[model samples]
Target: MGRAPSDSAGGDRLRFLRSFLASPRKVGAVLPTSRRTVDNTLDLAPLEEARWVVELGAGTGVYTRGILERVGSDARVVAFEVDAQLSSILASQLRDPRLSVVSDSAVNVARHLDGAAVDVIVSAVPFTSLPVPERKQILRAARDALGREGIMLVLQYSPLIERELRQTFTYVRRRLSPLNVPPAFLFACQGDPRSPAGER
Candidate 1:
């Protein structure tokens, strides 16, 4: 049998569940991404050489830890979690100098980056669940914020947005993770994306 959940982890799980209950559409998942999900999604990025990393919908900082482990101490990580309560928990839990937990929408990523050279973008945000406009905005922001060699890693339960990704990104590759709770599709996109007008 597995050990019982620790007090802190149990509390965190409760909070996560509460957030999902409060906003099912926004929260997207009842549980955070599993370790395998995080690893499979981030493997496509060159974390070792990455100087700056950005995370979208960093619900509970699962992928944040993975990025930190792979990168050097000098690297910077900026994570965006729209839910204030979840962001608070993430800030308190991950007290690393290299990490910044921002309580804002993923679309505001560029402003938070403030002209930094971003090397990798890992997104746990449920794009398919979001409003179409919001999804487009976040995708555009990711494309604009990336450095010349930057790569955006998107984890989704479905491949429904592959068309959108292909239009916004110059190249897109996907892989599936059957081990995850709901399973997942990991998209690795690189190069400067075309404008929305060009998408048509």
Candidate 2:
């Protein structure tokens, strides 16, 4: 396969704009995560003991690949791809036995694994244009899945969603990834305060 285009996420978003506009509501599948950005997010992970990695809107396995590269070989990754075509592609391409590609709604993150607490929930969903209710629900589910000591990392193109996370999580962090399309922001927050791993 040819190398994916690597253009500055600034004004020339290239593949990001094309992929993001592929669907209605001005939103599409997840934007491909850049390697540098992925490593940065992985560095933000609090617990070394985490076994479950839940990926929301894995899209084409961009961040999924990034997470896999950082986590242990036995770490379980539950990838939720809301797009059928993308899900099918991910299921076949990822060779790791630890990867489970689920073709389902991202809002059902908790239900898919029987309400189990995940160590980390990395979301690549675009929330700026979504209905407020749907946005709130997704954030709530992400918070719930953490159980205790669980964290949710959201990669967004705008600051609007960061406001939502601030109200819900114990503490919220905003990191700029200069490597991605549009130089996205990485919002990391603890779902619940009491269970924070004390790593902030």
lDDT for each candidate structure: 0.85, 0.73
Candidate 2 residue lDDT tens string, 75-146: 788999776766776787676777899998778887888767788989877777777888788888878788
RMSD of each: 4.6, 5.3
For candidate 1, write residues 1-200 as lDDT tens digits.
12212225567668878999999888888888888888888788889898999999988777877887888878899999999988988888887888899999998998898898688999989899999999999999988888877889999988998999998888899999999989999999987645443331
Clashing residue pairs, backbone N/CA/C < 3 A, model 2:
9-182
TM-score of 2: 0.82
Q: For model 2, give the RMSD to the true fold.
A: 5.3
TM-score of model number 1:
0.91
Q: Any idea what lDDT model 1 has?
A: 0.85
